[model samples]
Target: MADLDGDFESAESGASETYPQQCSALRKNGHVMLKGHACKIVEMSTSKTGKHGHAKVHLTGIDIFSGSKHEDICPSTHNMDVPNVCRKEYQLNNIDDGYMSLMDENGEQREDLKVPANDLGREITKKFDNGETFNVTVLKAVGNEAVIGIKCQTS
Candidate 1:
């Protein structure tokens, strides 16, 4: 019911008078707003039951530190809120061509990210994975890479 882009808040608003807050993960049948959570999208899949059934989005994510996997079902018709902030925890897979390749706990490729050492401070070559270690920060997504602000360690 909140003001969204233009007045297209609901798909059935033109002829219907009621709005449902929850939606199904298939056939785009439901709608709801979501809040931000520190997680990364590890995998995504889509499917449908039959010709008359709706489509669904299967999403898999991993907790940045705990490395626990989280799954969700999102309907195709659902008006989900894409979080403005993106966060990820990964291991220093390797560095090449002024870019860094990181392997997330889920073993997903989060690569080709160019992060400046000065931005991370202290020549951060730490190995973090399998509950060994991890870092958290707000990420701004620009194209394929993310711009992160590393919190400076205080003495």
Candidate 2:
């Protein structure tokens, strides 16, 4: 139907763009999608050609949020999808009921978000004091937001 086609076209146009990258192009400390999980590549190795006649790439990474190790192997020429990730800094405003209220540099308050489960997050949870300013890293990707790290702002 014409209406269905129009709606499909609009949805397709609104989708985010992703580029295919060769396994060899991936590097340590880079982000990659492995097994449908966004992971941070912590280690990578390339193997010489085997009887199959292709260099193989082995990657080991941890889930960005869950911290679970993920490992995979593929031919060096294989292509993979890379996720769009962005980091922004926010100031800590308050913490209550396991949620953090943050404000950007422009002083705009963001919706209270759950604290991350990393070491930095734990530190914030135990040491938060109202009115203390902190520099916090917010990881944004694919409509997800998370606090990755936090450091007290030095006077």
Candidate 3:
């Protein structure tokens, strides 16, 4: 019985650190889960063609945290958290063909750059948005892409 208790603790501890396996339970009704390495709200659009023709919103975010981005269509009446807490300034050191080197705030150098445009579901990939800082939610070093869920910071 002691061994069983120990195993239960270990399993619960591990589960605590990772994201929930089932994505359906994360968001509320009318909201669909966008998938990536780490998913975020990409876009949410709605039309008034139905019987109610209710208002809708288009939400677009990145899942660079999970190395992906996705789009979802939901009613515009919903509210969501636009989490940008992972912002740490990084410097563009070098660009080799398609790859770019990024130096983070800690001065840690990371290579293996893949353009955000190459992301599977990412639709918009403008040239590093002028003066916009990008956060590397997931990078390419661990068999993922160079970056994911990159967006410009406001204030």
lDDT of each: 0.47, 0.80, 0.44
Residues 71-148, candidate 2, lDDT per residue (tens digit)?
999899999877788888987777777787888888899866888767877788766754555778888765577778
C-alpha RMSD (angstroms) for model 2: 3.0
Q: RMSD of candidate 1 to the true fold?
A: 15.1
Instruction: List where candidate 1 sits over 4 angstroms from the true fold.
Output: 1-36, 49-51, 86-155
Full candidate order by lDDT, most accurate first: 2, 1, 3
Residue-wise C-alpha lDDT for candidate 1, range 47-98, written one tens digit per residue = 8765886687676665432346666777766654442334565555565666
Residue 49 shift from truth in candidate 3, angstroms: 27
Name the candidate that leads on lDDT: 2
- Tens digits of per-residue lDDT for model 3 on 1-111? 355544343233232222222222233222233432334544444455468664554445565444345665545454333322233445655556656677876889977
TM-score for all models, in order of appearance: 0.33, 0.81, 0.34
